[model samples]
Target: MPRSVLVTGGTSGIGRAVAERFTADGAGVVITGRREHLVESVAKELGAVGVVCDAADPRAVEALAARFDTLDVLVNAAGGLGAAQPGPEAAELEAVLAHWRADLDGNLLSAVLTTTALKPVLAPGGTALAVGTIGSERRGGSYGAAKAALAAWYAMLSAELGPRGVTANVIAPGYIAGTGFFQGAMTDVREQALIAETHTKRAGTPRDIAETVFFLASAGARHITGQTIHVDGGAFTTR
Candidate 1:
C-alpha cells in the first residue's frame, strides 16, 4: 500500500501544493481545512480525502485523530495571520487580547493539539512537519511569535518521538508569493522590496516550500529532526 499522508490546511497555499506533490507520488492523501466547500473542492481536484476540521479545537483534533488508523506523515500546514481586528471602538485591551489569542490559537495551538492527538497513531519511521515563517525571527509580532514558539515546541517533540523512529521538524519559508497570504495588501513596491531581500532576487513559491517538505519526509532525511530548515533563498542565512 502507498504511504498514508495527512496535511492540515490543505485547501490552498503551501498545504495544497504539498498535497499535490504527494498525490503525484502516489501516496494516499487526506487533507483538512476549516471550510467544507473548499475542502470538498480541493479533495476532488487532488483525488484525496477531505476533512473539515478546526485544528485549534481540542475536541475537534481528537475527533480527527480517531478517523485515522495509522499515518505515515503528518504535515501541520494550517496556520496564518489572524483576521484583522475591528476598529478603535472595540474595547482597546479586549480587542488586543482577542487578537493575540486568535493568532496563538491558529498558529501555535492548532499544531500542538493536532500533533498530540495523532501522536499515538503515527507510524514508526514516519515524520511530522510544521510550516513556519521567517517572521518568527524578526518583526512578526504575534504571528511570528506563535511560529517561534512552534519551533521551540517541535524541538522537544523530536526528542520524545525519536525513539519511536519518528522525526519532527519545521520548514520556515520567506516571502512566498501566490498564496493570498497578504490578503490583497501586497503592493508592487512592497513585493520588490521583499524580493530584493533575497539573494535569489525573486519571491519564493509554494512549490519551493512543498519541495522542501517532501524532501524532509523522505528516507534521506531520516536522520534529521528537531531542527528548523530555512527555505528562503538566502534571505535569512544561518551562520
Candidate 2:
C-alpha cells in the first residue's frame, strides 16, 4: 500500500515542492490551502487530492482531518511573513498587534493546530516535519519569533509523540530562490549579499528543502527525532 502524506500550504513554494516530491515517489498525497481555487488547481496539476482549509483555523483543520483517516507523513509548510499595512497606518499600534498575531497564527499556531487535530490519525513510524526559518536564529521580527516558538513547541511535541513511533522535527531554510517568498521585493544588491553569505555562493532552492524532508522521513531517519535540521547552503551554521 502507498504511504499517505498530507502537506499544508501546498498551493505554492516549498509546500508545493514537497507535495510534488511525495507524489512522484508514489505516495497518496493530499495538499491543503486556504484558497479553494488554488488548491483545486494544484491538486489537479499534481494528481493529488486538494483540500480547502486554513490550518490555523481549528474548525477548518477539523474538517480537513475528516477527509483522511490514516497518515504516514505530515508536512507543515504553511508560513510566511505577515502582510504590512499600506501607508502611515502601518505604524499604528493596531497594525503592529495584527501583524504579530498574524505571524503567530500563520506560522506557529497553524502547525500546532493541524498536527494536534491529526495526531490520532498518524500511523506508527510516521514523521511530522515543520518548515522553519533561519531568521529565527538571528532576526527578531514577528515571523522569526513565531518560528522560534515553533521549534520550541516541536521539542515538546516530540516528547509526547515519540513513544507512539512518530518522529517530530523542524527544517529551517535560508535565502531560497525560485519561490514567491520575496514576491518581487528583492533587489539585485540584496540578492547578491544573501548569496555571498552562503559558503555555497548560491541561493537554496525549494527542491533542496524538499529533498531533506524526504530523507528525514525515510526509514533511515527513524532514529532521528526532536531535531531541527538546517537546509541553508551554509548561510547559517552551528558552532
Candidate 3:
C-alpha cells in the first residue's frame, strides 16, 4: 500500500510542492489549509484529500488528527512571517507581545501541537518534517527565533520518537523564489544580493525543498533523524 501522508498548509508554496510530489508518487496524501475554497480546489486538482484547518489551533489540529488512523509521514509547513510590526520605539508593549506571540504560535506551536496530537497515529518508520528557514541562523528577528526554537524542540522530539521508529527533522530553505515569501517586497538589488550569497548563483525553488523532503521520507534515509537539513544551495554552509 502507498504511504499515508499529511501536509499542513499544503495549499501553496513549499507545502503545495511537497504535497504534489507525494501525490505524484502515489502516496495517500491529505493536505490542510486555512481557506476552504483553496483547499477544495487544490485537493481536486491533486486528487488528494484536503482539510480546512489552522494547524496552530489546538482544537482544529485535534479534529484533523481524528480523521487519520495511521499516518506514515507528517510535514508541518504551516508557518510564515507574521504581519509587519512597528518598531519597538513606535509600538506599545502589548502590540509587541502580540506580534511575537503570533509568530511563535504560527511557526513553532503549529508543528508542536500537530505532532503531539498525531503522535499516536504515526506508524513505525514514519517521518515528521517541518519547513524552516536559513534566517534562523542569522538576522532573522521574531520569525527566525521561532524557527530556531523549532529545531531545538525537534531534537528532543527525535529522541522521544526514536524508539517508536519515527524520525523528526527540519528542512531549512534559503532565498527561495516564487513562494511569495517576500510578499512582493523584493527588489532587483536585494534579489541579486541574495543570489550572490549562494554558491549556485541561483534562487532555490520549492521543488528543491520538496525533493529533499521526499528523500528524507524514503527507506534509504531511515538512519537519518534529529537534524536540520539546509537546502540553500550553499548560502549557509555547514562545517
Best TM-score among the predictions, by candidate number: 1
Candidate 2, residues 104-220, lDDT tens digits: the string is 999999999999998999999999999999999986599999999999999998999999999999999999998887779999999999999999999999999999999988999
The TM-scores of all predictions, comma-separated, are 0.98, 0.96, 0.96
lDDT score, residue 114, model 2?
95
Q: How many clashes in candidate 1?
A: 0
Per-residue lDDT of 1-239 in model 1, one digit per residue for the tens?
89999999999999999999999999999999999999999999999999999999888888899999999999999999898576778888888888889889999999999999999999998999999999998889999999999999999999999999999999999999999788899999999989999999999999999999999999999999999999998889998
Cα TM-score of candidate 3 = 0.96
Candidate 1 regions with alpha-carbon error over 4 angstroms = 84-88
* Residue 54 displacement (Å), model 1: 0.6
In order of lDDT, best first, we have 1, 3, 2
The whole-model lDDT of each prediction reads 0.95, 0.93, 0.94
Pick the lDDT winner.
Answer: 1
Q: Give a tens-digit lDDT track for model 3, residues 1-239.
A: 99999999999999999999999999999999999999999999999999999988999998999999999999999989886466666658778787898899999999999999999999999999999999999998999999999999999999999999999999999999988787889999999999999999999999999999999999999989999999998999998
Query: Model 1 lDDT vs. the true structure?
Result: 0.95
Candidate with better TM-score, 1 vs 2: 1
Task: Give the runs in model 2 whose Cα sits over 4 Å from its true position.
Answer: 84-91
Off by over 4 Å in 3: 84-91
